[model samples]
Target chain A: AQSVAQPEDQVNVAEGNPLTVKCTYSVSGNPYLFWYVQYPNRGLQFLLKYITGDNLVKGSYGFEAEFNKSQTSFHLKKPSALVSDSALYFCAVRDVRSGGYNKLIFGAGTRLAVHP
Target chain B: NAGVTQTPKFRILKIGQSMTLQCTQDMNHNYMYWYRQDPGMGLKLIYYSVGAGITDKGEVPNGYNVSRSTTEDFPLRLELAAPSQTSVYFCASSYPEGGVETQYFGPGTRLLVL
Candidate 1:
């Protein structure tokens, strides 16, 4: 079984500053990682994902995440924060290598507060 | 285009009441899923359907039932509503076959049971 952990419940950052939402995972083998953002009253929007190749993956709205195999972490990062980015972020993993299981397992989610 | 449509954006149900949450997707995706979002907890999959007339339980499917009568429609049913079931329900659809196509989500239906 695979699981994800978002260590931070909430992360506060001023606009124009860098921000990071921590995420770690435990899986039997190489895992597929994903990041999603959810605004108030809205469903989650896909941000980025790491399937194979490149350790650094970029996705919608100027967001990116780093996949560290040695550490089993996939941390979401943005160079410049915006108030619009103030929302709930989630980290998910799918271990396709786990004997034909392809379901996604998600973290508890990190609430981001980007202030102006 | 209506990517994913969920009926009754907000609903308040009394304890033990039964209701169904309707979901449809125009994308003709083969896979549909129902997930509930609670505060601090990410989305927990309640049920999923890959094709018509095929449904399966997810991470949390204790009091929920679902049916996929058609390719576009997947409805979630709550037989006995409880306060523990009060959460934001989201419907999502994605293409199947192992490739990593993104899952499109509906606006969400907020349900409160008291």
Candidate 2:
């Protein structure tokens, strides 16, 4: 079964410090990875995706993720964290076997807290 | 465009009651989906529709039903709601445009069953 795993339940970092949220996935064939962030009482917002090329992918709100195929990881990163960046982050992988539009299998989310 | 919208920002229901969560996307997306999110756990796909009249079961489709009668509307129905069904329900739509098929989501609906 295709799945994604977020090893950390919560990650804390000081404002203006670099932050990393770890994610690892297991899937057959090529992996299509995605990152989504959810704020309190709100729906998820797409951050970025790793389809084929470019190990490092940039996304919305000054976020970027590096796709490490050998490590089976796609960790989200930011150069400088902000208090507003604190939220729940999820990592997902697409199940390619599904017909038409593939469905996503998500990991247990990780909460990121950026302290001011 | 309003992207995707879900009605009833918050709702509380007694066990055994039923309700329909309305979701509409003005983006003319060909695909729509319904998911339930619980604390700590990531979202679970309840149902999805590829197009009008084309519906399919997803990872977690046991207690939910959906119908896609039009390209813009895909409503999720819960029959005989239970306490376990209490969750934040999110509706999302996506257009398979080019290589990037990004799913745009709505501000979720919080459902609580007593």
Candidate 3:
């Protein structure tokens, strides 16, 4: 079974500081990892994904994630935190055998609190 | 392209009452999914369709039924609603082609069962 684990329930960060939301996955074959952000009373927004190739992937809002195959992790990171960036983050993974549109298995999510 | 659109942004239902959450996507995406989000839980796929006339159960499909009669519409039906069914429901769509794996989500429907 493909699953994603988000270790932190909430992450506190100060403005202008770097932020990291940890995520790990378990998959049968090559992993397709993705990050999504959701604001209060709103739908989820796509952030970034790691399919293959590069270890470091950049996404919207100057956010990036490092995909570590050995550790089976894809942790989202941002150099500078913005108050508007505070939201709930979800980590998802899909197995290769999922065939089409592998139903994304999401983590419990990590709430980000950016204080100015 | 309107991406994905869902109706009834918010609704309050009485226990045992039934309702349908409408979802439509204009992207011609072959895959559509229905997921529920709780207070702490991120998102759980309730049901999904690979294409028209084909549907499958996800991690949580109980109390929910979905039909994909057309490529553009995927409606989720909630029968015999209960308090446990209260949550935010999301409709998502994605293309089967490579690089289109990213699912575009709708604004979501917040349901409260009493």
| Best model number under TM-score | 2
Predicted candidate 1 versus true structure: per-residue lDDT over B63-109, tens digit per residue: 99999989999999999999999999999988633367567789899
lDDT against the true structure, each candidate: 0.88, 0.92, 0.91
User: For residues B1-114, could you state the per-residue lDDT of candidate 2 as single tens digits?
Assistant: 888999999999999999999999999889899999988898899999989999999889998999999999999999999999999999999876447577889999999999
DockQ values of all predictions: 0.63, 0.77, 0.75
Global CA lDDT computed for model 1: 0.88
In candidate 2, the second chain superimposes onto the true chain B with a TM-score of 0.97
Best by DockQ: 2
lDDT of 3 at A12: 99
DockQ of candidate 3 is 0.75
- Model 2 CA deviation exceeding 4 Å by range: none
CAPRI tier of model 3: medium
Whose DockQ is higher: candidate 1's or candidate 3's? Answer: 3
Models, CA RMSD each: 1.8, 1.0, 1.4
TM-score of each: 0.94, 0.97, 0.95
Give the range of the ten consecutive residues with the poorest summed lDDT in model 1 chain B: B95-104
